[model samples]
Target: MIAEVMGAICVLIGIPFFLTGTLGLLRLPDIYTRLHALTKADNVGLGFIILGLAIQSGSWLEVARLFLIWFLVLLASATSCHLIAQAAFEKNIKPWTKEE
Candidate 1:
């Protein structure tokens, strides 16, 4: 019962992060800001979801798989975000500032 409750709580908590990231992607002005939101918030949200699933996992193998998936996603998102930002920089794209 306790594990179930915790899992549910974790899932619920993860959802808002997803929503916030979506909103940030839609509402933010620039590639860098959108990338920041998409990468950071989504990664944390995924972590929470993985943790929730791991809490309910039937065996160590399941938990390990979930964590491995999360790690892979983390690396992928970070690398992609960096590559994109570097590309933008090379192209001379400027970030949005408050004065603008």
Candidate 2:
């Protein structure tokens, strides 16, 4: 019962972050800001999705696959974000700071 409830909650939680990423990607002013939004959404979305999947799965193999997928998402997101950030830095994109 608890696992079922938690699974529902986790799945619901994942949706918002995914939506946020989509909206931010569409609405953010520039590349760097968009990237920031992307990272936040991607990480949280993946986390929640994995958590939900883990909670819902009955078999060990299924859970392990979810874990593997989570691990790959983390690895890929980190590497890709790092490269994007590096490129932004090299291009001298000014971060949206509050100093203005």
Question: Best candidate, TM-score-wise?
Answer: 1
- What overall lDDT goes with each candidate model? 0.93, 0.87
**Over the full model, what C-alpha lDDT does candidate 1 score relative to the true structure?**
0.93
Off by more than 4 A, model 2: 96-99
Best-fitting candidate, scored by lDDT? 1
Least well predicted 10-residue stretch by lDDT in candidate 1: 91-100
| Lowest-sum lDDT 10-residue window in model 2 | 91-100
- For residue 46, model 2's alpha carbon misses the true position, in angstroms, by 1.6
lDDT over C-alpha atoms for residue 73 of model 1: 95
Cα lDDT over the full model 2: 0.87
Q: Give the lDDT of residue 77 in candidate 1.
A: 94
